[model samples]
Target: MVVEEREITVGGDARPARFTSYDVEDFPVPTGREEEWRFTPLKRLKGLLKGADADGKVQIDVDGLGDGVTVTSIERDHPLVGSVLSPVERISAIAFAGFTSGTLISVAKRAVVEQPVTVTLRGEGGTAYGHLVLDVGDEASATIVLDHSGSATYAQNVEIRVGANASLTLVTVQDWARDTVHVGYHAALVGRDARFRSFTVTLGGDLVRLAPTVRYAGSGGDAELHGLVFADAGQHLEHRTLIDHETPKCRSRVAYKVALQGEGAHTVWIGDVVVRKAAEGIDTYELNRNLVLSEGARADSVPNLELETGEVEGAGHASTTGRFDDQQLFYLQSRGIPAVEARRMVVRAFFAEVIAKVPVEHLRDRLTGQIEAELEGSGV
Candidate 1:
């Protein structure tokens, strides 16, 4: 199928526009040749591209709900269900139209929640669809964790809103069983003087694709997006991110790292940032790095930046993909460290920066152990 190319005018600059709609029929089935779906494997999606009905089930459970937090179930037409997010792709649009109910988690205004909220979704089997909304009130502070496990074919949409002067940290862990296929879209809106931090950790699945986007609702907004991926033999993992700076004095930073091992292990990372003319004084930077640990593994990294006004404070992007650093490994071995132990140390250090940023101690420790386990299983 040939998809028409469209562009939108932003501050006198014409740029490619992403087609989005609430109707599933508006998006034709992807053949894997389109720019947005090029790296994804269409067959592994398990009929999601055809907008099939979600006949499976995924149990949802929440823990650590404090006094200031509330979780409720609402229908698709709820006022807050689609306020912060719109479907940007075929799978997401299908999920929006198929989900029977939506989950909404709200934090009270000016309230502080000391405990971290954890949402767990366990898939039973077959195909499933889901929608989730997280709303942080003005001046509120909270931490959230979304954990995915079990086995099934799933498509989901997550919407997040950070009110004025609020702070939110979200950590998403994708630890699905081996034979599972999943696709998710995460969209966040940052308010004036607010801060948003997101960390995505993808470890298991047959084929997983995640698209995360962020936009500024007011000036002085700040956002940071970080991701980590480990792809084993015959696994496919992909992450795509977009940051839109439409207000002045906003800032955004994106960093992602990937480790590929075993034969047929493939990973892809794409980072895109756009600065409009009204976004003067905005500072943004994006970086992506990939580490190949064995032969026959592949990694692809792409970083794009578009600036409408040259008056911005600073803007830059960088991407690098390479094998293990021989010099670093040699230096560690020269210090009397065993070859295997030295290799483990190097891999730990590579991911330490991103893992250290997690506020929860137990989660950080668990991630560390998982990475080590992956290395041991691969005989690295």
Candidate 2:
């Protein structure tokens, strides 16, 4: 119930939103009616706070992903930028005060970078405010790709920091441009024996919301999260994740795969794991899987766990949603191999263990050609 923290100005520099000095408060408020943000369709999150007090500007196009990626205009008190003005940042701040000059993609400590650092957020008009900060030091290693395809319409905020015994591999591809409207927020911090890996591939967008948060503060830390999403016909794809072990010999893992086709497509998945209480020797796991090819496509899966104290050594969570298994499509149409390439070879073997952990082989063959063009427009 403490909401009086507002000073946030970008290109001319200003700061007051301390995000409660990182503990972030507001009486535990972060609602989409809770329950892990209840199926994530908050009327498209009320149009991202309706223009964040106007004064809009979003037109930036930098061609041919080249040369250590440089585009700098920071100085809104630039010390790795800031925002998330409490009220628990309206439950995970998504473009809080519309952006005013940002783009700081860095890598320079033990620098072992071989290509693979592409950040593309091409938007023109409407609402486009983005903030990105990625710094990986200490024994450094890197691979980062964030591509929000052309034809802009937007709200995006991203923050990433991984140092101390550092290692980071991040890949996010949101195929934007279908009269776009997107709200995104990603925050990650991992240190001391650090290792962080995240991969998300979402096909096209009409209305998309993605919130990815990961924190494993030191103590032999490690974290890995993988996700693949495919939504067709008048699309809507939403994903929310948070895995925090907060110290004491940490480790985390999460896996997500979703597929839905045709008529007003919608796919939603939420996975959250938190083990606090000083996180004694923790180890965590979470999983969610869904497949519903047609019949007016739709899917929803929720996996959550919160353990304050249990002197944790291991923890678990899981969820599943079903469809597409008419006896494995009649045993592949009785073996003549004609049931549309055997249902695209069983949805690519149920998405080949999250696309074989995509360490960039042409972005895993361009995400397996957008999952076989959504199974040939779902005639399969």
Candidate 3:
């Protein structure tokens, strides 16, 4: 395959160009100096960047199979495997080339699924490669939850397709073991007049890096992406997002929040949005916020917005990283609340906006409990 490169002007400044290819050999070994790999700890990747062979397996399970849903296995060379996603980095390309078969979940046309579908992937140990695809037919509606657990070094790719006039709500939870290292790429293509909403929750793993990108297949498409990250001691969690507005009259919104505590806890968030010349009257915005709770913890946030045409409806980006607000804590303590409980309240309020938007009630309650547990364990 041919390598494609393009230059983009973001915030009136020329950013580094990016390339995409399907072949692993097209990408050079990252030296931790490139713009894309600068914030990542390459030494702790566990050889995923080198396209190492899988020595273990990841067991897959699915539940809530309804009237319109179909789940099956397909070969790597299946027609729909690479129809919606193209590899933009070495690890994703390596995963695409290494996996022999993948799981496909499809929804029939004009069907409505009342029950939410859940897919669980459990790892045994060692290294593994995997792929998954979710296809929503025209005029259909469905909700899906992808739950990840167990311990392993895993690299996977997920492709999603939303047909014309369809709606899809996807939530991906990463609750891996402390010894696991995971790197994944998720891409989605939204058809004309389609709606796509995604929520990503990252809470575990030693080193986890995930990239999610979206592209519009036709005009009048809408996309919204939300993420939550909580890192404990010695944990590294990173999320990179790209919203490419290539069609006219489309809209996109992105918001992500991070909370870091304990020594050596680190988090990174990169938000990139591009509006091509042909994408006239487009509206887009991205925001990222980080709160550091203790010493020896760090957070990095970068937001970029690019516009090729001046006829946009609105385009903007914002990123903020700082410690907790003293005034808020003081206000809570003055109300006769204990200091420890006040701190917990402040943290919960910080993440409440995102948590409240989750479509599942049980999931929202579970995530709240998990956040409380993190605060108690870290003695925040």
Candidate 4:
């Protein structure tokens, strides 16, 4: 059980091709090596380190950028784009010991982008890695959807930045093939008086791990995160969220729900909030709930909070993980509904709270359809 660990420098402007090649050897295990990835399956990580070449040219698609919503390629030469590139390439370099190209996108300052911009990451041929960087400028408003799906197994890293006075809605849907091994890193910096809302849906992948990190650097700002994870049969899903309040008068709230079923299906939630001394008058809280559907399934919810100031308005955290609510199930079945459908109805009702918070109508509807399909299999 060796968890491979690699020293990844903050990637500069260099793309994958320029670096001298080296084989991934004698690397330390990543399990226990990184606090953010403590609960992940490092044994299965060996697959990425087997050192295979990338499957070659990957294609990314942006769906329906209607009028008023512009799509512009982020120049690779841009200083900010190059510096803030996601760590996907570094991870892929460790697993495959090779270089890979990635993507970057940015919205103009003070621009109101009405239509939601959708980016799809599709893999082909073999194992691969992807990086996406998104920047919303000051006073701008936009909705972004990043979809990960395709024919091959791989990992992805996404970085997002919301400038001061800006508002951004981000939705991520992982609908990868059943055979894919997906790990995602989401990092964001929220500026003063800015608003950021993100929703993550996990409905695919053999093993999926998502880490979303946020830092609120401005006063009178808010950040919200919601996640829904449903796993069944030989699946492993793990989600970690970190919220940092470095400025006063900033607030953040996070809620995540997970449902698991079948043999060896495991899920873990790690929610952390840190309020610095400078972050006085802050309000922050987090909640994680997990539901188990079978005897063999397992789940864990861990919430951690650090407060450095007493001047805050309010602060707290809560976590719970359990089976379906027996009372709710019983009530449904008593209404003449079959037992399986009744159980699923309860589960769907529980998850609906988070789904309803999505601000984008199209994304909300699409996600509802997917969730319903998953519940249908549960016999609801």
In order, how many clashes per candidate? Answer: 0, 0, 0, 6
Task: Give the TM-score comparing model 4 with the true structure, all chains together.
Answer: 0.85
* Candidate-wise lDDT, in order: 0.90, 0.71, 0.90, 0.73
lDDT of 1 by residue, 1-380 (tens): 21333465666764655666788778878888988899988998889888777788888999999988999998987888878777878899889988998899999999899899999999898899999999999999999999999997999999999999999999999999998889999999999999999999999999999999999899999999999899999999999999988799999999998999999998999898988777899999999989999999999888989998888989999898988899999999999998889888988998999999999898999999999999989899
Ten-residue segment with the worst summed lDDT in candidate 3? 9-18
- For model 3 the TM-score comes to 0.96
Off by over 4 Å in 4: 1-27, 31-36, 49-52, 56-58, 66-77, 82-99
Candidate 1 at 206: error in angstroms?
0.9
Measured with C-alpha atoms, the lDDT of residue 317 in candidate 2 is 79
Total clashing pairs in model 4: 6
Off by over 4 Å in 1: 1-10
Summarize candidate 2's per-residue lDDT along 1-380 as a digit string, tens digits: 34345444422333233343223233354456766456666666435543444334545443333444454657446876653222134423435345667776767677777667777676654656676777776767788888887655566667778888888898888877776767677778888888989898888867787878887657887888888988887688888887866578788888888888788788887787867666788888888888887788788777778776678888997788787788998988897888778878889888877887788888788788879877877786
C-alpha TM-scores of all predictions: 0.97, 0.32, 0.96, 0.85
Which is the winner by lDDT between candidate 3 and candidate 4?
Answer: 3
Q: In model 1, what is the error at residue 131, expressed in angstroms?
A: 0.1
For model 2, state the Cα shift of residue 369 in Å. 39
Model 2 misplaced stretches (Cα beyond 4 Å): 1-77, 82-127, 132-152, 160-179, 188-205, 209-211, 218-233, 240-264, 268-280, 287-294, 298-312, 315-317, 323-380
Worst 10 residues of 2 by lDDT: 83-92
The residue-by-residue lDDT of candidate 3 on 1-380, one tens digit each, is: 74456676444554444567889988889999999899999989999999777998778899999999999898887888988887888998999988877999998998899888999989789889989999999999999999898998999999999999999999999999998889989999998999999999999999999998999999999999999999998999999999999799999999999999989999999999988877899899999999999999999998988777788999999888888799988999999999899999989999999999999898899899999989989899
